[model samples]
Target: MPIQLAHAATLPAHADSVFLLPAGTTQLPAQLADLHEASRKYVTEQLAADSKLITVNHYSHRHYFVVASAKGSAHLIAEAMRKSGHQLHALLKADKVTELYVEDLSESADGALALALAEGIYLSAYEFEGYKTDEKSKKPAALTRVLLTGAASAEAIQELDYLLQGVCLARDLINAPLNKLNATQFAERMAEAGDAAGYQTEIFDLPRIEALRMGGLLAVNLGSPEPPTFTIMEWKPENARNSQPYVLVGKGVVFDTGGLSLKPTPGSMDMMKCDMSGGAAVTGVLYALAKNKVPIHVIGLVPATDNRPGGMAYVPGDVLTMYSGLTVEVLNTDAEGRLILADALAFAKKYEPALVVDIATLTGSAARAIGKEGIVGMGTADEVQLLALKQAGNRVHERVVEFPLWDEYAEHIKSDIADINNLGKAEAGAISAGKFLERFTEGTPWIHLDIAGPAYLTAPDSYRGKGGTGTSVRLLYDFLKNQE
Candidate 1:
């Protein structure tokens, strides 16, 4: 469940405490002045040490004190608050503290500090115990609500709440196993989300996909028993800012077993269920925008399928004609994401979008290069758009490192028999994939986000849980909001 947020007229007498202090401060805020001198001294000492501090205050109710230093610029402070929020949640869980009251005394210009704090606390408390038989006994964190006692606007808090909801939804989708979240099921979930979030959704099943001649999706789905689905979602508020919609395309490979070029079971294929994270993030961003009623005309397209080495799976050297009538020579069956994404990118051309961004967990070379620190971005889009995206990434801490989409990279994917090859040479594999997708853009301004590294986490990190990190939803949401 999403953490409930409400403005506190005054800090409750019995609520647990979270104090946001500026860096290098030895004094406590007036609100926390009444804390025991020992606890207060501890907080000050910890602040001086420049470390996260949480301690028990032997107040009337033995309230816990969470002292977090909010130093640096707004982005840095926001990132710090997120980590602090997770730390606060961990302490609360250990102490069984249910109610948290937060006050930002950092005196920073960040009006949304409370929102970031709430995001961290609540997201850190999230648990995916759907398949856990002992869930009832596990008893996760009890943090149910967070009370704010500072200058955060209600609108900003509401917006953050909606975005967190979307992020949580993305996490749930990405964490689900293939048996539960196949292509059709994923589309159905998207349809349900669109309905609930005030967006229009149209799901095209196999026959409709075939009619559209989406050979990339068809070729990828050849191995799986489940059929492919193409899902389109739109949110066009009456007062939208853009004359033409911003289009987003996501790769929805629900579970990538690498098809005919199968992945090693115990090695690379363990977390293939998260291959659809890009699609999940697109859906999450739309959900956030529509739920918040952001006045932006936006559309999302996701081509969904599973790539398994089943009967009639397309093998290397096979030439597949795409939805755009471009033939691709398959060099590696594992390069299926680019193929499906290519179809979606081509399909997006009908919208005549103001700008298009396609995101995918596409290449391990990207993961190797960045090491789960940022996204690998390359595109034919305008520099201004790329800058906006990078700025958004900085704000949300999902930073992007731009790679060149040079003509030389395109040369690496040249096909002897077909228009292009799915896989490029081993060097600069991520850029090669981007170059291949750029061809399908047909000169439309487009950005490609290769999110292979940070989409799914093998271990818990800060506010991001152990499974799906829901990487791009916040980045895209922030970018769209700034566009307005």
Candidate 2:
């Protein structure tokens, strides 16, 4: 989507949709009588009758203003909107209408303006067109432009631009159909995007896997026809030429069929395309960091693969050696994310980063624990880093709640034939999964995000849509910016 700036009067003539701030129920004084009457009778009156409390109808050119009453005292709603086909304006090709908007905005002078710009771009760029055909469209084209009502300073503009870039990259990755976005292809796309965004990149094929003896990755790739790939992205700011890097690892499971263990019919295998959301998330983060020219040294490690029940798929009772030389007994083939991440975590350790953070759509138990509102995380050390992530998440509305990685949980993975097992017993499944990955982190200050719930959404709300939520990108961006 393209971002544009315009004066309030010129906006109505140029935009397919116009957003406005309506006067409050008791706030607008009687002196501005005529203007207040138009706002209250037309806008607030309509909003009060609806439950979603979102859209307010306007007869002129099908424009709508989203409003809410609150303390901050500005009518910017939320900083989000979107355009969809078959809407009133789309039917006439009068340019796409802004489909979503927020009300009750902050009046703070810092990040508020930029956030508003980002909100507009984000709310307007979403589409869910993958499954339907009989109707005009289940999805819509990308939002190509946005018309803003206020002056966004240069710094605010840059911040908003980078935020939108992160969101767009995530939307593109999640919005892709499964057939086009498996492991190898994802790596290729990231490489291309990295090149264009000015980051140094490299990819590891199956041969390199064998050379490096990345047994965990090799074991997971035994099923799919598409080969597995490991991708590395590096960004060193001009000023940080001598500093050690901050590393991030993301689990890149493109499609998970639960391997030989398999999944249930009601499991919704079709949405597995979004299983690589963590990878897409980090990829988006890298794009933003570079595009915004953040003065920091960074490295991103992605271990990519597919888990299918092929003829030679790794099966139950199989023992696999990992890059860390630790052997894992595959008690359940469906428990495959930790196996792949073990190799990637070990690989990241060599860089000796100031910190290592890995994000994965690892466990459904996490969803059960934290629901769809926040990310569930477990860090081996550094309470401060974890707390900082929590604060950042809370501010962005992408929250993270940390769990304990108790050494006692390792008892579940204790195996007679190998060093450990991929998964523990069904109880405490989320924490045990974190324990499994913790083994591979050695002693680094690390945070493991089991983003099973927040990674995908079934409906649109706030600034997020019904598909991939791109859950952690914004929080990660916020945290990184703090170090600077």
- Can you tell me which runs of candidate 2 are displaced by over 4 Å? 1-106, 111-114, 117-121, 128-143, 149-151
Model 2, 339-394: lDDT tens per residue? 88889898898998888899888998999988997899887758787788887776
- What local lDDT does model 1 show for residue 324? 96
- Against the true structure, whose lDDT is highest? 1
lDDT of 1 by residue, 186-305 (tens): 999999999999999999999999999999999999988999999999999999999989999989999999988889989799999999999999999999999999999999999999
TM-score of each: 0.96, 0.83
For candidate 1, the per-residue lDDT at 249 reads 95
- As for candidate 1, its clashing pairs are none
RMSD of each: 1.8, 4.8
